[model samples]
Target: MSAKRVDSTIVVVAVAAAIVGAVALLGVLGQAWMGYAPSHLLTYLPMILLPIAFALVAVALVRAALRRRQTEVGQS
Candidate 1:
């Protein structure tokens, strides 16, 4: 729908990804330190999610900046 809505959703997703990634990283650590074996998906989730989170945040920021510029130009 709206740019604001898209931005909000992107931010929410980014936060979720980061949280999940952190949890997965902890699982990985537990596996290494305490011999708690995680599944293949869990073991690799941090690698996937952390980068996605970073990219999503960057996209959200750029989208926000572009939207702001568009609004400013429209008002001028």
Candidate 2:
């Protein structure tokens, strides 16, 4: 992959991870609606996932910005 290239898949995966994390947390809190309590491990899954997801998204944003900047610079 080129230094200035940003992968849309990476961005999409990060967003999905974040959403899954948020949903997991909600599921844990809303166990009553779920009809069963989630295991502790499942409850902790979101805590472990959210930061990684956010970090990936941050990296994607920075890469996309760099790529855009390079494109603009090359055009000038």
Candidate 3:
């Protein structure tokens, strides 16, 4: 488990989670807008999860970027 492998896994998982969250959110919102009550659950669940998912993705990206910068500096 090298640092690079761990980081790559994190990034992949975060991105996939974020995408799933976004899709769920959109589906719920769309259904609700069309006057479906059951979609409320979908809307709320994804609304909560979406932000967390996005935050995870953002953190992963920032970490990767910082690591790249550090490596570049070390090489120079």
Candidate 4:
């Protein structure tokens, strides 16, 4: 996939989805803690990708932030 170009818009969507999925998973986990049905947790299993997606977005963001900071430091 790196051999071809990917759209920036898609990456943004993935990052958004990743964040929502992670929050939903956390909510489901909270429900389990409150003595809700164990089956409810099963529904959230598919959200595991959120953490991975979140990590990807996080890395990219961190890199960008550091680069910007480095530029500012160099200029000053």
Superposed on all Cα atoms, the candidates' RMSDs to the truth, in angstroms, are 2.6, 3.3, 2.6, 5.5
Off by over 4 Å in 4: 1-6, 38-42, 45-76
Which structure among the candidates has the greatest TM-score?
A: 1
- Model 2: ten consecutive residues of lowest lDDT: 1-10
Sorted on TM-score, best first, the list reads 1, 2, 3, 4
Q: lDDT of each structure?
A: 0.90, 0.81, 0.76, 0.63
Q: Name the weakest run of 10 consecutive residues (lDDT summed) in model 1.
A: 67-76
- Residue 42: error of model 4 in Å? 8.0
Candidate 1's TM-score = 0.83
Query: Candidate 1 — which residues are off by over 4 angstroms?
Result: 36-38, 73-76
Model 2 off-target regions past 4 Å? 1-6, 32-38, 73-76
For model 3, residues 1-76, the per-residue Cα lDDT tens digits are: 9987887887777777778778887887787788886466676767777677778778878988888877755543
- In lDDT terms, how accurate is model 1? 0.90
Higher-ranked by TM-score: 1 or 2? 1
Ranking by lDDT: 1, 2, 3, 4
TM-scores for all candidates? Answer: 0.83, 0.71, 0.67, 0.45
Better of 3 and 4 by lDDT: 3
Candidate 4 per-residue lDDT, tens place, 1-76, comes to 4411233544676677776777677777777899986454445653566766767677666766776776655543
